[model samples]
Target: MIGLVLAAGAGRRLRPHTDTLPKALVPVDGDLSVLDLTLRNFSEIGLTEAAVVVGYRKEAVYARKDELQAAYGLKLTLIDNDRAEEWNNAYSLWCARDVLKQGAVLANGDTVHPVSVERTLLDSRGGGRRIILALDTAKRLADEEMKVIAADGRGVRQITKLMDPAAATGEYIGVTLIEPEAAEALADALKATFERDPDLYYEDGYQELVDRGFRIDVAPIGDVPWVEIDNHDDLARGREIACLY
Candidate 1:
């Protein structure tokens, strides 16, 4: 399976840095960028080919694509998202519908986590689960987090940002495995989600699939530190987490 990364968002909260470069290109550990760590993780787990959905500052990624590919020893395909600045990630992910048909271990470019998260999802593959999300059940929930409510912590009952923090089980860490069997259906769900509302998160697509009776499972990464870089505060936290990786 090829690796997939959604690096399209402008990350308005992270301005100046995101003014010229995408959030994925923001440096976390000195010169090492969020995209650098993501590609390294994918390579560590044998995902030698990766497709990155780029928008906001797409040219920035193109400028460094060759360097990143050489450093990670992986082939990179950049997918353009024309509506990236105007739309949310639900459409950004939908832009990758064609490449995802080959099966993919997809990760959000702005999230900082170790290769262990990638390993957990890869190891749990092929057991009747078409979609497997890397969840952090151990983290404290906040209103801004992409939360999930699972039935007995195995089957995902719901995934949304509007859920009450007290009632949610955990956060969906923006990493997922999409098997070939579920690719077409997932793409369709993503399309429906974006059509209904351009501001919807890709998690909305997961909810759509769950509503359609797809068996999407969760693999909880207990007590594992990870941070989704959105604003300046998160960038600091991401640096700390990057050291752990």
Candidate 2:
């Protein structure tokens, strides 16, 4: 499986840093950006190839593509998302449909996590599961977290940001293992999600999958030091924990 990164968001919350570069390029560890850590994690997991969905100042990524490749020792394929500035990540993810068909370990470019999260997902592969999401059961769920509601055998029953924190099973940490068997359906679901409401998140596509009777399992990452950088505070937390990773 290849590594897939959804790095198309403009991240308006992140100012000057995102003026020219995408959130993925925002540095958390000195010169090492979030994308750098992601690529490094992928390379450590033996994924020799990676596809990045780029938009909203994508030229920044293009300029550093060769440098990132050489640093990670992996080939990179960039998927363009023309509507990144106008739409949500559901469409950005849809842009990489072909790459998803090849199976992939997808990580949100703004997330800073350790290689253990990827290893946890990889270790949980098989047993007829098509898609496995990295769920953080240890984190205290809040209104901003993308919460999940899952059961022992029922898998994920719901995933949304609007859900009450009291009822959530955990938070999806933005890492997922998409098996080839679920790719086509996932792509279709993503298409439907964005076409229905261009503002919907890709997690809504996962909800679409559940609505269609597809089983999506969850792999808890346990107590892990990870942060999804969305603002200055998040970036600060990312810097503090990313170095530990």
In terms of TM-score, the best-performing candidate is 2
Give Cα-based local distance difference scores for all models: 0.91, 0.96
lDDT per residue, candidate 2, 148-217, as tens digits?
A: 9999998999999999999999999999999998999999999999999999999999999999999999
Candidate 2 achieves a global lDDT of: 0.96
Cα lDDT tens digits, model 1, 125-149, are 8768889999998888889999988
- Residue 20 of model 1 has an lDDT of 92
What TM-score do all the candidates reach, one by one? 0.97, 0.99
lDDT of 1 at 201: 86
Which residue pairs in model 2 clash with each other? none
Which segments of model 1 are wrong by more than 4 Å?
Answer: none
Candidate 1 has its poorest 10 consecutive residues by lDDT at 146-155
> What residue pairs are clashing in model 1?
none
Q: In model 2, where do residues sit more than 4 Å from their true spots?
A: none
